[model samples]
Target: MGGTSSELRDLTNRLYERAEAYGMEVKTGKSKIMVSSTTNTSADITMNGEKLEELTKY
Candidate 1:
């Protein structure tokens, strides 16, 4: 079995909370987050990492 879109959304919300606690700004795009500062942003919490993991994991 694999995770669904709703699961990915849930994980994203969790990550967003974490990011906000760290003073990072999160902007939602079509299916991704537009980070405020390019240099300080990490690709891990963005759509690719979290979303992909959520979709692939059982």
Candidate 2:
């Protein structure tokens, strides 16, 4: 949804903070970042300080 990595990172930060505020756990095990680009840019995207796994298929 974000146009840049930083923007996407910011969104994750907000999501993590909000979830913590509500006492909800963001399951990192079920989280993933699927990139359609030819370059690896989503390695920086994370949830709750843990990097999200990138999938090539599904």
Candidate 3:
């Protein structure tokens, strides 16, 4: 999903909501967001009231 930050955040939020409905949850502490581009593409993608960390490189 390589799109604008807002798009990604929206997709993430929808995903989290669907997962929650199925009795599943994303462990935010072990979750991360990675952008393929070199430029910054960060957005407030929160799950379970916690913002996910961004992975700079990996």
Candidate 4:
């Protein structure tokens, strides 16, 4: 699915929330954002208020 950066961030936040509820944690450094679109827009997703690094290819 495709969405704006804000939507992506929200999704990430929700994921973190669910993970927390289950006593799990997100490995932010191991996480990445893959942009399939060629829009040149930056993927500024954050988990626990910290920005996640974006990868050109995973």
Candidate maximizing TM-score: 4
Per-residue CA lDDT of candidate 3, range 1-58, in tens? Answer: 6487788888888888899999998788998888666665455667768989876542
Quick one: how many clashes does candidate 3 have? 0
Cα lDDT of model 1 by residue, 1-58, tens digit: 1144455456787877898899986554444533334244323344424333211111
lDDT of 4 at 41: 62
Ranking by lDDT: 3, 4, 2, 1
Total residue pair clashes for candidate 4: 0
Each candidate: what lDDT?
0.47, 0.76, 0.77, 0.77
Assess the local accuracy of residue 13 in candidate 1 as a C-alpha lDDT between 0 and 100.
73
Candidate 1: residue 37 Cα off by (Å): 32
Task: Rank candidates by TM-score, best first.
Answer: 4, 3, 2, 1
What TM-score does model 4 achieve against the real structure?
A: 0.80
Off by over 4 Å in 3: none
TM-score to native of every candidate shown: 0.43, 0.74, 0.76, 0.80
Per-residue lDDT of model 2, residues 1-58, tens digit only: 5667677789878988999999998899898766656675444788876888876432
